[model samples]
Target: MPAQVICIGSVLWDIVGRTPRNMALSNDVPGRILRLPGGVALNIAQALAKYDLSPVALTAIGQDTEGDDLMKASADLGLDMQFVHRPDDLPTDCYMAIEGANGLIAAIADAHSLEAAGDAILAPLTDGRLGSETSPFSGVIALDGNLTLALLQEIAQNPLFSNADLRIAPASPGKAERLRPFLTHSRGTLYVNLEEAGILVDRLFDSSQDAVRALLDAGAARVMVTHGGRDATFGTPDLITSQTPPKVNVTRITGAGDTFMAAHIAAEIQGASPSDALNAALAAAASYVSGDTILS
Candidate 1:
């Protein structure tokens, strides 16, 4: 399939440990452990693929066993890997997370390889291959904050991105500050959770609506703020819309935000109204967390 969008950031293996009971520090419980292909960009891409949107990955992977396996997995999921950067010297990246009944306990992302690969990962966009500054790729680009802050900053002002519709994700709250540059990009839209929005705005917001306003005030062109089990809001300088996510038992939380972001993007691409898009995204996320098969 041809690429409908480009996903730029970490493409790695996810080692997840999930338990049905609440857990604390040093608490070991019966749980399920699984290894899956995951990353901010990959998660969003996988979800997009579910909507039959082919996304091309533009991240660095290694030439090792893990990288080979990840490539096969991404292919099986229908992601376009032809543009992915694979360096022989760098080892494959990975993320480990433990989720308990209450919520996420901890996560560690080993994305040093991605950061080290640097601008090399973006060569395809600049080398007159997939696209170039003279003829920029004028499609949607899903970017994750796993890339270094310097690269993110460059991308914010780079002419190569001038014509693209950019969708940015902070990857995690710890990396939220890295998205500062994109806040001012005219065509960029940020997908963040309540805490991530607070980190970006330097203030605590009591609700997603408040966070949406704060983010727009902080110079973000557009923002979507989601609060776990609460209302989520999408805001622009001129309009703000809020909707409650459908109530569901959250059996997992790792990739719910990405699912919401992907679903929303898909809905908009298919010409859904803003209200319909938000409802579709919320419904998809609710289904994801409820461990149901997402049909959207």
Candidate 2:
């Protein structure tokens, strides 16, 4: 089947430890450990697949055992992997995070392989397979800030992306500033939390509405700011909308943002209104964090 969306960035394993108790600095607690196929881009792709949208993965994965297993797992989830770069010398990437009843305490991302592979993963875009310079892809593309700043900047200015509906997200708060290049991109829409939005604008925001206005003032063509259990706001220069997520116990927090972005994209593609799309996204994210939806 043809790919309906392009997901670009890290494709890796996630080693997550979850504990029911609230945690603090230097605290150790007994918890369940699980290893799953995850990464910002991969998580979004996996979520898109759940909506029956064929998503093509554009990222680098090593040719080792871990990479092979990851490929099998992604295929099982129905992600198109024909465009994934597999380098023999590099090792598969991984992300580790510790989550408690409170929230995410700490996390580390080892995306060196993806950074080292550089723009090799994007060959399909300019090689006439998906798109070329003369004819650019006009479909939806989801990008993550796990990519190096240089590459992200290039994509922001490249003509190949000028016509695409670009949806981007920061991999984490630490890497949020890497997405500054797209602040003025005409077709780009950013998905970020309150903190991440604040980082991009270099100031603290009190609420999602404030962050939305700040990001738009900072030249974002469109932006969505989520404030955990508070309201989530979506804004463009012409119109701004907000939706409050359903209150639910956050049993997990890792992939909730990705689920929101994917669900929002799918809803918009299905011709939902701005208000309806925001509601759908918030509901999907609430389901994910509440552990009500089964994770693949």
Candidate 3:
């Protein structure tokens, strides 16, 4: 497959309210607040862009001022922003989160706009620009479970993605089950954490290696399971490999997993072996979690 342009699942801005100190309960703390173009899809696509890969975002942002600003941001990042469906009545989607020194305490994703827009965001892919159902875009496609379950199921069944190299991540641990449809996809590669992998396999795994094995047994074509501050596992149809993440002081953790996924894809696309890919991803994620790398 030609691996030029990749499409990330759903794109939107993230409004993050973060504090330096950790708190146990819902005690409001004052700290730096930031709003950026984020989402599992956008973050992964942005990281891919850093590697000089042109990525198109298949997402819905509303036809509003926020959406306009988001489009400008996407363009500035050198992303292909066409096919971002905007409905007149729907407002642009957003994700709001609170992060402390520990990790992300809570998050609310308002992606109703994308859900309403449905497959309209994929119009370009189905048209001549990218690919259609007949001659599908056989490129690297990064998918996320931020999409509705039904849409994911449809994508799993769609011939347009049947031939593409699929690298997928669940938007969150709670959404991991939504990726079940792609478990059997011939070309799907799953990037998941131990918790998410356990969710998919409907069991508990004491180690990343165990999680990787369980995921492979559950029918994933390829699997990578990350354990924070522990060993991360990578697997092909025949072999499974492991790499330990470099130890670092964890400053933040919101986009760390997404960074790892992007780095993994970029490594493989650059012809790295599974061990090399996992190592690259681990280094990238370690730097990101240590707040050494910018923009995930």
Candidate 4:
């Protein structure tokens, strides 16, 4: 049976501006600019599709023209999006970014709509559509930190996730601290970068291994910390391992982490061991970042 995945978090469009040449402040160079559907949950869901998970998104978007178009784009991709909440007053969220040859230059995210929607997006779970507090949704759930701290705490303590296997990703370093609530959850697996891992562990880490160890010691059952192009560490109850990511020509910087998270979750759902899952995740992320145009 295909693993049932509930992707809970933001769903929005990303506008990225790229430059082939190295850049800095006041440097204006010509490069390709593209727009695509991207958000923590949406990105993971899209990447999970590649692994045949067909995740259903639990998110909210506005009823604006852009929102309609983005929904159409999603439908074209065959994402099972029955859980998305559409509000008339709210405007769909969007993110914009600029990237140079060196790396990411600047980025701005406008996810206020999602933040304002709050637990309303999770109606399915509360209203017995997805699951309830009494009988929570089972199967794998890719949870994001884009949710408010209150909601995160609720999820951590609520019975809704008592039977669910959770794969979590912090939407960004700013909100990474929100996941601290889940440190004690038995079913949680954290996928984070070095800096964000430090936020959760409340200290600085010298290496990926250090971060993973600290997070594991701080009550996380399993932790995977990625140090950019450096070695990625996986720490679990049984073992700790590290794997280097294959070098790839960097075309874009966004969505790479989500790609890794999604692939890892899918691999685990398919019964891959931790080491095998990490390797598969790195390979999928390398392929995703190396080039655009992932041919289905």
For model 3, residues 183-226, the per-residue Cα lDDT tens digits are: 86544888888899989978998999999888888888898898
Residues forming the 10-long window of minimal summed lDDT in candidate 2: 287-296
lDDT of 1 by residue, 1-296 (tens): 44498899988999999999999999989999999899988999989899989888999999999999999999788789998999999999999999998999999999999999999999999988779978999889999999999999999999999888899999999999999998766559999999999998799989999999988887888889999899999989999999998888889988888899899999989889888999999999999999986521
What TM-score does candidate 1 get on C-alpha atoms? 0.97
Task: Give candidate 4 misplaced runs (Cα > 4 Å).
Answer: 184-187, 292-296
Which candidate comes out best when scored by lDDT?
Answer: 2
Error of 4 at 195 (Å): 0.6
204: Cα error in model 4, Å: 1.8
Q: Which residue ranges in model 3 land beyond 4 Å of their true spot?
A: 1-3, 185-187, 294-296
Q: What TM-score against the true fold does each predicted structure earn?
A: 0.97, 0.97, 0.95, 0.96
Report the lDDT tens digits of candidate 2 across residue range 1-296: 54499999988999999999999999989999999999999999999988888999999999999999999998888789988999999999999999999999999999999999988989999999999999999999999999999999999999988889999999999999999999856549999999999999899988999999998998899999999999999999999999899999889999889999999998998899999999999999989998987355
Off-target runs (Cα >4 Å) in candidate 2 are: 1-3
Candidates in descending lDDT order: 2, 1, 4, 3
Q: What's the C-alpha lDDT at position 164 in model 4? A: 83
Q: What would the TM-score be for candidate 2 when compared with the true structure?
A: 0.97
Candidate 3 displacement at residue 289 in angstroms: 1.4
For all candidates, what are the clash counts?
A: 0, 0, 0, 0
